[model samples]
Target: MQESSEVAGSIVSEDCLDEVIQEQIKTLKNAQTAALSAVTKRRNEIFRLMDNCDNLHLVKSEVIILCKLRDKYDESFQQYEKHLTDSSERNTVNKRHSENTASIDRFITEMNNWVKESELQLTADLDRKSLCSSSTTRTKSSRTSVRSARLKEKARLAELMAQHAMREKTKVMEEQELRLKQEREEQEFRLRKKKEQLELETKIAMSQARERVYAEADNISDIVPKDTPSPLNPNVDPFQPQPSDITVDTPQLKANVPCSSSHCRFPEPNLDMQLQSQQEMFLKTQQHMTAAMLLPSIEVPKFKGDPIEFATFMMAFDARIAPNASGDADKLYYLDQQLEGEAKDLIGGCLYMSSSEGYTSARSLLSQEYGDPYKVSMAYIKKLISWSALKHEDPHGLYTFALFLIKCRHAMTNLSHMEVLNHLPNLQAVVKKLPTYLQNKWCSLAGHLREEKGGVDFADLVEFVYRKAKAANDPTFSKFALQNNYSKP
Candidate 1:
């Protein structure tokens, strides 16, 4: 989508404005018409999806797609409304707008209907199934029946767990996509605002230049008004206009004078003003850059004394400010400003030390307490170990687990103890936290890995879980999986 936007932007110019806008309208209309047809054709399949949905997740996905299509229809309709400038254009736009409005309204009505029906059906099915299962458990308690029931219950739990995990992944991916979309929109908005600001500023600059030129025109004429005295003799009556002076006006104040003194050899006001405006804007931009050095964020982020976080903070501080500092005093001042809580208190004693010694001592103390590789690696590992065993249907917990595992792996690599994590106790402890399906995949993969290498490694486990976590999040994966289970209407 961003690439498409960029392509559209690059192709648009003053000369091609009408062409680009028309293309935008045509493309949007085509997409909306296609979406309307799909929704119309798949009405029954959509109903079936809701009927078989475990909850209302599938219904929500369909509604989001519909809402997006409706919004595009609206945007295109609005653009056409804006495009209409004549009576004939107005009639055409009005007709198209009415048609699109009807489509969008219908789309919204269908979405509302889908939500209402799916919610009621899901509630009824859940209650019915729960009551039926409980009744079956009590009535059919024979040994074979109990065994089958247990198997069925286990499978159902696994299915729910898988669903939960997928939902979490989907949520994370969607949020990421949303953020990207917002950033793009913000960038485009800023670009537009900047262009407008420049144009407005240029117009004002030129207007000022014209005013200055016209003011200077007053002093250009040597011929005085009939009642005004000449500069050489204020008491004398004003000089009468000569034939040449009556016909022409000029300023002889500077070297660049006309041969006939009929006109001042003024530079083109428009060209001069443009160059002045560009120079001024460039200078202001340079001054802002110099003053900010780092902007959007001007200061280094503060840090407390968490060993796991200390390494990142130290690297950032060093990279951003340390190299540019004049001496230890500046460095200490910057460091002192950034530290807080335990980190700040830990370096408090070092402030009494003189000059380089104080800065040196404070830095050393910070390093010993919070930048130790062993301590940092242990902290990362402890976090991994401390994670609660993921509940059977907790997708958010699983996502957090994957994120932390990746962080832990990064810390281990930095600590030069990557192999330490693959030890039997550590490896199995983390594995036991995964859901049943993931455990099964791990077992199968571990067995093959052992056969190939004489022992299994933890990287393989991380990679496997990472892949599953990603797959679970992907909406496309969910869509295809859903489609596989049901034919389209």
Candidate 2:
């Protein structure tokens, strides 16, 4: 009982534990109490037999009642400590927890102690039964001795009565012996009848108690399994599923290369022949690798006169082909190859100029016309203003809108054009472009941010919108879970 109290104490304070477990402990602590605990106590259970030392009904009855209480206690405790952790009380040491759990631990400990003490008392029971058997054995033995002596005396009388009548006297003695045997059988039958009557009464009492248990609660049968599990090992893991074979279907590559049938190899080659073959093979493979490099891994973006596209196009051109080109002439040629429509024609005159001056002239013309930070930044604002109002605040549309805002934010980052994006009027216009529901969410978010930082920025709204958009996306989306999405305050 103390150990269970200690386990419960580790979580809950003494006061809360008292409120929850004190009531139950009160019932069990006293032998006079008529609760479940007192009913299944050691003295009245399997430890001792009935008064006659014949009926085992008390043992079976105690076992059944204990099992019922065990189930009820298990359910109550499971609900109590299901997800309750002691760590939650780290900041508040006085906080009470696991109120139901305290009661469960108390009941389990009480039952386990009952079982233990009963086993000890069983030793005394064994001695008592042995004594009962010895007494019955001695009485039966004395009766047998007396009957044997009487038979001996009768045989002596018969011998004195008849030498010629010996056969008739022997028959008469046999009849007397048979009569005595019948009388002994009648006595044993009467004892058996008495025991049977006692057994029937015990069975009736047990049946009435069982019916009362059923009448008290029908769900009791459902809650308690036939072969009840031990409470100590409640956390035992169920059988784990074994890993199964995984099969993947993929497109198989087929041969497209022309097969060679030269049949040109020699088992032993002259030095000149081997040297020539090696040189030819190495040069041919090197040429093939160089040809492979000419095919671009990333498809080049075709830029028109749109300033919005200017920053990304220039960044891509600069990263991939521009730095590798030793001469400006090569850079200009690659740049022209990546332009189209208004952008290509805008640099047409410079393309015809001499290589030395042509590249510089074309490059400056393109940057001046399409790569101005102010122009690029204005284009982003224009995009936001021109964005069509959403028909509904659906996850896909919200996600798409969030992506556009994110792109604008990323583009303006290096350009230092955040002042335009952070303008209150511009932010309001962006919020206005949202569907009714999201507009409200954005307002709430903006209010929260304004309280914290005095004002909300484009980055803040983008982050806020992106989070909700991602969270509202379907569970089939592999990237995010709702808990993970909204984890931060």
Number of the top candidate by TM-score? 1
Candidate 1 local lDDT, residue 22:
77
Worst 10 residues of 2 by lDDT: 260-269
TM-scores of the models, in the order given: 0.39, 0.37
Candidate 1, pairs of clashing residues: 169-473, 170-473, 220-250
Candidate 2 lDDT score at position 436: 87
- Candidate 1 residue runs with Cα over 4 Å from true position: 1-295, 324-326, 479-489
Output the TM-score of candidate 1: 0.39
lDDT of 1 at 273: 64
* Number of backbone collisions per candidate: 3, 0
**Can you tell me which runs of candidate 2 are displaced by over 4 Å?**
1-296, 323-327, 477-489
Worst 10 residues of 1 by lDDT: 221-230
Deviation in Å, model 2, residue 228 alpha carbon: 99
